[model samples]
Target chain A: MTEKGSAFLDLMGGEVFRDGSQGVKIRLTIEPHHTNPRGVMHGGVVASLLDEAAALAIKELLGLRPQDSGPHLLVEMNVSFLAAARPGDTLEAEASVLRMGRRVAFAEAQVHRGKTLIAKGRFTFVMQHD
Target chain B: MTENLSQLGIKGEAARSPFSGFIGNVLEERRPGYSRLSLKIEARHLDSSGRLHPGVLATMMDSALGAALRDVRRKDEEGIPGGTVAMDMMVLQVVREGEELVAEGRLLRRHGALAFGEAEVKKRGDGTLVACAYFVFAIGRGSPR
Candidate 1:
């Protein structure tokens, strides 16, 4: 899941990986621009990373391809920040598919800096086909 | 002479933001328990689906809710300052590039070092709600835990 066309990922930065060969995961380095006023990883960045991971996971579970399955949109997402990450820190996030039905898919995710959990959340993804 | 949230600090922060791309985000105003922010949708903000990226909306809620919570912390007489520690959000509608977004957040309550808050975002033109969120934060004057 390169998501090569997403400029947001290009600017904010993210790397997508497959989870268990069935789920999706994202890795991001806490960059200078990713920090907030206090210099910790911005909550916005955390949220975005989670969303991206969830989207990737959903696509994997649903077998939705960019050229075939249309598109996947976030129906809902929630995140809880457990710890703070700083610039130069490499954070890895992974999403789990809790369930996948007809229209919606549920997922849970966590971002960790090595052993430290930075954040965790769940998401609802809805697949739209054209 | 201001010892709090100096103009220079805000200006300096606006520079390094990751969302400072095409559909750039701007911090418009901040007040105790409340804040207003906006983003101008740009071509680059779109995803592979040719729609506004969900992460962008999440980022907006993240920044807006955090800013509002920051102001709320400033008002705390205890003199504690921290940052947004947790957030839960929902995307209620779809969005696209070229559509400006306006977001606002207000504090729901504060207990000790923790603060609870909620925020909403809508299209600037028709005020159609696109997304909303609730946030929790921990603040301290020196380093927010």
Candidate 2:
């Protein structure tokens, strides 16, 4: 993993679910730091997970190359949360590439707990040029 | 001074409530998506051209997506265990600082292991469409590795 990758993994404060050539999976314990006042995981946390997963997915598709300090830029995304996440709940996010192109990469991700679908999204990242 | 912002419950409460943040504030149901969030657009939240920062709009849209999915599950009383990851997104509008905007995200489709959704952000009061996005989420267990 890249140094930035390792640092991001540390910042997520979650467990790993899947680590493969395609992408990485991460799990988080719903805590006050990850939730809003209503007892659910904060949306920003969700977005952060999405951003990380999307970037990682692209990196994996790119074959773990050391090109630049910046990995990828999130060009755009759409996401939906299906249920409320509470403190102590296990939240996992997994990602993979749908399409990897020269200038952009398309990816998909899911977050769930034991078959209970919480949220899912798709993102596009523009490859940073040197 | 910043602590008081949390008390008002207008500053992204769903992401900070007790039940959800404090006691599962009920205000979220009414807002639905980005419109519900008390979005604070400031000079810092804008781009160099004096428009709402794409990051700020992105953050708001991401929040709306999470809220919309949460809202759907709230209707069924089913607990959402996993968090969402953005698979892809597109921004179609530009906003400026001091300009009020509202966001709306809705669930479009759900399969056995995946879910689909879209979001829209617009200028509040004037109802000017600003941006829209689409997302895919994996619904299961464990953490990101």
Candidate 3:
């Protein structure tokens, strides 16, 4: 595990899964802040989790550095909400790189509540070099 | 025939595109390259940090860009059409929850088969800049094809 993964785990209070290419898996509890009037988790909350999963996966791919000399910025993304998660349910977001080019990288993520897929999306990021 | 796109999940009022039965709402038919919207943040859109969820920011910008693309393309077409696909995007800043947010999206430039646009999100109360995003949408002939 990279230091960045460990740090992110500590920050989010979730364990980092062991996987090739540093794919991240974090289980999040759907709290009141994440629920909707229907008592299900808000779609926006799922989006945030997907975003975090993509961003951290990029950081892990780059290697664990104390200072970020080159920053990664998202250029575009399209997400689909397929299911709803309720409060108290444990949701997990998993992210991985679909393709990494010299200037841009493609990442895909799926947010799940146990075995049910709540949302998934593709993200394009521009890598800034120092 | 005039149909409201919001009703079909094409637009949302301060949230996902909420389709109302009302006919010909001006917000849905905004021009391509120039789409604007304002909404007062409510309790339903905040995160644990009491800030506007990034997903909301993403959705708002995506809607604005999608509107611009829809307007711009239909203006040139000869027949009834559908919608575009948002291929990718990035949110640059965190939006504060409960602040009235003003969103503006402009068609930046276009590459063949792909259109690029930028959206700026700002706080309505103090006008403090919030999040900005760039999106690339795939253009097509008609409704979400």
Give me the candidate number with maximum TM-score.
Answer: 1
- Per-model TM-score of chain A alone? 0.83, 0.80, 0.77
Residue A81 displacement in candidate 3 (angstroms): 0.6
lDDT of 3 by residue, A1-130 (tens): 4323322223233344544634556567765444432345544455556765776567667783322323556656677666767657888788888877788888888888778887888887777666
Candidate 1 per-residue lDDT, tens place, B40-144, comes to 777667665667777788777767666666545444434343567877788888888788898887888877677788889999989999999888877644334
Chain A only, candidate 1, TM-score? 0.83
Model 1, residue A92: what's the lDDT?
87
Per-model chain B TM-scores are 0.75, 0.65, 0.65
lDDT tens per residue, model 2, A1-130: 3233333234446444454544466667777655642445766556656555665566656666312233455667666766667777887777888887778778887778768887777787676567
TM-score (2 decimals) of chain A in model 3 = 0.77
Off by over 4 Å in 1: A1-5, A18-23, A65-70, B1-23, B74-81, B141-145
Ranking by DockQ: 1, 2, 3
Give a tens-digit lDDT track for model 3, residues B16-113: 33211110112443564776656556544543334444556665665566556655554444233222333244555555545677677789876555
After superposition, which runs of candidate 3 have C-alpha atoms over 4 Å from their true positions?
A: A1-22, A65-70, B1-56, B59-120, B123-145
Backbone atom clashes (below 3 Å) for every candidate:
5, 72, 14
lDDT of 2 by residue, B1-145 (tens): 0122324464345444422222122223333322244454555443223444344455565555655655434333354455454534466565655667666667777565455677667777878777766666544332322
